[model samples]
Target: MISFDKFYSLFQKNLQNLYKNSKEIESIFFLLMTHIFKCDKTTILLKLSKKGKIHFIIYKKLIKKLWELKKNKPIQYVIGKAYFFDMEFIVNKNVFIPRQETEELVYWILQDNKNTKNSQIFDIGTGSGCISITLKKKKPKIGHIYAIDFSQKIIDIARKNAKLHNVKISFKKVNILNSDIPIQKKINNNSIIIIISNPPYIRISEKKLLHPNIIQYEPFQSLFVPDKDPLIFYKKISFWIKKKLTGIVYVYFEINQFIYLDIIKFLKKIGFFNIKIKKDFHGFFRMIRAVYYKKK
Candidate 1:
């Protein structure tokens, strides 16, 4: 058994050797203690004051997980869970980790639909079903929520997450680029339908600039687009919007910070009228909301 302070000091020193940023070191420490050890920050602090020692078995497990982190594996993947939209989600290498920017996308949708009744939501490329599941959890009045991803394995994980959150959602396996499956065929004319996606928008050319944890561990197909076609998923999903959306169709996307203008232009060309872009916490243009109201 090792004292809490001793354990923290040794673990942080190990992380510091891998990460130059102190904030990252501290954040990882906090995450590991809370998520892995099931001890909150305050609890850990209190334990430190009392010179509490962790069980040797738990300490050994921590050391093993840290070894994976040294290989640039994301801490979320190492722990097999992540927190998004104030809820815990099961995550693995098969899906993209739910991001903070994606939470902003969820926030915008929740705010827009705060007063809305009887709404149907479709999430394209719902990696972990975070967006759709979060919406259903937050706004229980939302009518059918459907999420799709190309990988059946990924859809299974998303479905599990929805179950974990105790939210009802439909998870489907469909490649959005080739899918013609109409979502929610029997919606009432007055019901608002929102479609949201946080598709792969990073350019392959910019791949090297991303942190090793993301590029090395997160699913490559979910993080990057070909340099020649950075907006491929956006364009394909936008075309789907043109096809299947019949009601007051509101579209939301978490986009690559660099190509938001391009996305805006594409939406305009595709006849989406009321389009808006939003910035994330770092003030990067990371989300866009557009509307296409069907002719009355």
Candidate 2:
């Protein structure tokens, strides 16, 4: 067992080798410290720059974990949870570590639905239930949220997250590839205001460009698509909703910035009008939104 200050000093060198960015190292350090000390990161970092001797045993395990991280494993998986959209979720190699961009997607939806009292929002491909849960937290008056995923295990994690947050959300394990979204559930169709997704837009050909953390650790089903047809999920999703949507139904997607025109064309073909492409905070075309309203 090593003392906290001693371990921190030793880990700092390993941190520099493990990550290109100091900030990521800092975050990982804080996350690990919280776990190791069995006290919150804030509590430990704020109160004791040094923890007493039992801390040495903790650092022994932590050093091994840090070695694993340098191999490109996600810290979220290492920590067994992820912070997304200001909420924490149980995460593992079983689920995609929720992305900061997806938080932008949820914030976009919430911003649009701010005036929406009793609005119903659908979070398709609702991995880990981050988007759906965040929506419910931000807009509790929302009539309902229908969240779905293809993986049962991932949905289990999502359900746990919803429970942890004490927010009610309808969850399903049906693969959208073989079946349409379940319309019979708590979807308040009349008030259905938004249909949002952060679907699998990554093309297999583009794999080389992805961060090693995503390529090596994240679930393939949740992160990728066939190179021949990268927009497969979006196309099928659009086809499924064409005849069903009414009211001011809006569809949003977190897009692959490389194929903006292809996505825009697909949106028009699917009958979504007034389509709007939006940039993430970093000014990348990371999201798209469009609306279709039935006749008055």
lDDT of each: 0.85, 0.81
Encode model 2's per-residue lDDT on 1-296: one tens digit a residue: 56666666676777676477888787888887786667877776754464655455655688788887778787888889889866789898888888888888888888887877776667888888888898898789866788889888888989999999999998887788899876753445457667888888888898998777788889888888998999898888888777555567888899999898899998887677898888887889999998776752
- Say which candidate scores most in TM-score: 1
Residue by residue across 46-76, what tens digits does model 1's lDDT show?
Answer: 8878989889998898889878887888888
Error of 2 at 270 (Å): 2.9
Which candidate number maximizes lDDT? 1
Superposition TM-score, candidate 2 onto the true structure: 0.91
Deviation (Å) of 119 in candidate 1: 1.4
Local error of candidate 1 at 18, Å? Answer: 2.5
Candidate 1: pairs in clash: none
RMSD of 2: 2.3
Q: Distance (Å) between predicted and true CA of 292, model 2?
A: 1.7
